[model samples]
Target: MLDTYFNFLQNIERTLGGGRGVKYGLPSTLQKVIALFRVDAAEIRLNQPILAELRLPSQFGDFNRITSETPYTEAVITGAEGHLGTLVLYGSRQWSDNELRVVHLIAQQLGVALENATYFAQMKLKTSELKWIDKFGDSLLNMLSSLQIQEVAGRIMSATKDLLEVEEASIMLKDYESGDLMLWSHTPPEKDLSIRLKPGQGIAGWVVEYGKTAIVNDVKKDPRWEPAIDEKGGFDTRSIIAVPIILDDEIIGVIEGINKVNDIFDESDAQLLRTIAKWSAIGVGNANTYEALKHTTEQLADAKKQTAMAHMVLNLAHKINNSVGAVRVWAMEMADELKATPHPSMEMRLMVENVLHNAEETLLMVRRIRGATELRPGDIRPIEVIEAMETALQFSRVDAAVKVERHYEDGIPRVGADAERLVEVFLHLMNNATDVMNGRGTLTLTCRRAQNGTVEIMIQDDGQGIPDHLRSKIFDPFVTSKSDGLGLGLWMVKLYVELIGGKISVTSTVGKGTIFRITLPPWEK
Candidate 1:
């Protein structure tokens, strides 16, 4: 519509005898009126005067300086029944009434053209803004699926920088424990920047402290401007828009766009940033929730595993106790019959004594095994190391060919432990020694008080020592050299010993012997 009107003006100028054309190509009809009035210059104004100007048909020097003596006329331009602006002509000629009417008719058309052009430009600007807003919304939606707080924050900051056309942007979240604003993410990737602010410290801080949006057009002019940041980062901040990231009526953080490119920030920029801040808060909230849930799941899985292990231990203890009890009964009966024989030979006497001792130790071991499965803090007490070793040795059933010796210091302090659990530990070490010896090595048990006020026990055996490769992981579960062993004995032994406030260690040489040392805290009355 505006182009058609402009074409009409062009044809009018051609019809009029105003030489070839004018500088701004005024309509020939309007040109004839300007010539009749001897106007040197003409202007077409819209909404505000001087919005546009029409070229003169010929050189009309310095028309702006035309005095009252000069011939000139002013006419109002009306469009859509509303006053658009004025058409003013400066010249030195008399204008007839017919000529004046012609100018008015053309000025009215000019007004409509101007109005249409104005609306067109405004619509184009709005279209661009809507596109950017759509893109911004899309970017935020993508961030919603992010499970990492840092990733969400970085995306938000990058989107803000691009959408707002800012030189720098950052997201800062408050540290709940320390009451400080930690810079979580920023655009342009400032690897060396470590920004932390207290509440009410900087522009970002002010937004957080007040839970409001702030627009600083000139940092130097605003008293709230914090120069320390610029000085530290070597940046000159000319403008900024900071808005609080609010969640559930609480400000969790702040989003800031600094130094808008080629323009000062306005309320409109603040409004955009505020919208983005809302979405960012939601993204951060979702990410945090995901992380918390993941941690909880892992903890629950660990608890379940521990529960299963405990059940397995209890079941196995019950089965072993039943079988061990039967063996103890038969062994005791045979030992009694051997001792009852009159004038028994020395060898026969020795055999009977060994049988009796083994039976007693087997019974003690059965009790200990059962006790191990039912361990509790209240069942713990001070245990004499020598008595526990004696029971463990007898139960170990060391071969008659293997020499067994005991060296226990008199008055050695008792150790705080579960008696049955402690005995189980000794049984594991002795059994391991017997397997390495293959039924023909020396096994020595020793006990003494350590300088640390703890009772130290050592079980030394001259057997085919543990292979060097297996020593490091000997105490680990499911690690063993025995074909029939489940490999958990030493691991459990280590576990039980530690539970009773003790430490266990081993020293061994391949093809020679191995020594297992344990230190237990002394029991206090």
Candidate 2:
């Protein structure tokens, strides 16, 4: 293993001078060891990025920091000269102690060598700056692609630390509404730095407040730079550089790199930092816009649906009114014909009188229909559960065909929903159950007090149950097990229940029966 490490070091030198820098490349011995243990996350972060970019394997890809609490196994090794870097094996689960020891040694040697390479390469301006700029750009792009904003910020923070050769790094974002700057991401406390600053309160805040970049070559001499490292993170503040993240003339956030490792940050460092900050601003703006548009579009679609349903109700009322008018005309004609035929039989005469009476009643119902509307905020009030169930049964015409059973708990609490809407739901469910019975089986409606201060309604039918395969998608729009169904009834019922902050569920046993349970928050008794 010793000989292999020595040889690999020689190969790294040769590769850096002759080929492109890669981030990870393993020696034959390390490769064999990694393969034997089935280690999927073998990584190499060479100290000398130039050598790393040339010698490291491309398969390992890039490394970034995390915003959330990500559990990982990490080992840090210091060289003879006290040079520091890290070897992180992230993800959960432990490796053998023997393998861990070797990993630590390998990571130390790799970090030291890379560090040496970077120290020597810093003398060259163009090559070092170009490489760091490319790395920073790649890190920003990765953050933009991430689903979580904090994770992306974490990655950018760590990458900035590496590229700037700084001891600590952080990203602070502004809350426009609160006018506060918050620590969005930072290296863990164990990583040798602790720094926290409020927006417009500390050096981080100054950058956001002024919308400009600030560089303190020496922290001791700066007045705006507060030395509260002990109060915040328990570390000394020496040198600091902060840059604002500006988007569309507004300062959205700031990124700061603290304590340069070797030299004070120069114009080259500032150039690279500003370039990264520009790209980051663009990514953040796009994400914010997308989230806002999604919320607005959803609300607009809901409004349109309610409007369309209201229009349907109006049209239905008009049709019913016209039918009632025709019935009134027919009854008047029958009365006139009966009166003109004075010798008519008693049965015929009585039938004519009955028809006239029914017509008058039907006209009164038509007037009521014109005034009746869908249950809305103003139309809803506390109503008795059993009474609503009975009304629904009458509307569904189920009582005439199916055997009806009603189980009501005395003093069952009222619910906070539209009484008419509840009736509509009961009617839909009862009619479905009746159809399942095909005019033979029993239809049961039960209302009772529930354990959670809510009312429970169960509609059960002793008929062929819904198929198992269809149950999973039963609430989805346009999914129906019925042959003649429009497939919207169950979907609409679920939507209405959810809108009212209630729940509905179904359970069925094949060849036995199906039961639907609905629970709603109760109104005051």
Residue-level lDDT of model 1, residues 136-159, one tens digit each, is 555545544354667777788777
Candidate 1: residue 520 lDDT (0-100): 88
The backbone clash count of each candidate, in order, is 5, 14
Lowest lDDT block of 10, candidate 2:
16-25
Candidate 2, residues 48-150: lDDT per residue as tens digits? 3443533445223123533246454556734323445555554445676545655555455454344433433332343456776444545544544432355
Error of 1 at 238 (Å): 2.5
Clashing pairs in 1: 12-28, 13-28, 24-55, 38-91, 39-91
Residue 250, candidate 1: C-alpha displacement in angstroms: 0.7
After TM-score superposition, what is the CA distance of residue 54 in candidate 2 from its true location, in Å?
29
RMSD of each: 33.5, 24.4
lDDT of each prediction vs. the true structure? 0.70, 0.65
lDDT of residue 125 for candidate 2: 41
Alpha-carbon runs more than 4 Å astray in model 1? 1-136, 145-148, 296-525
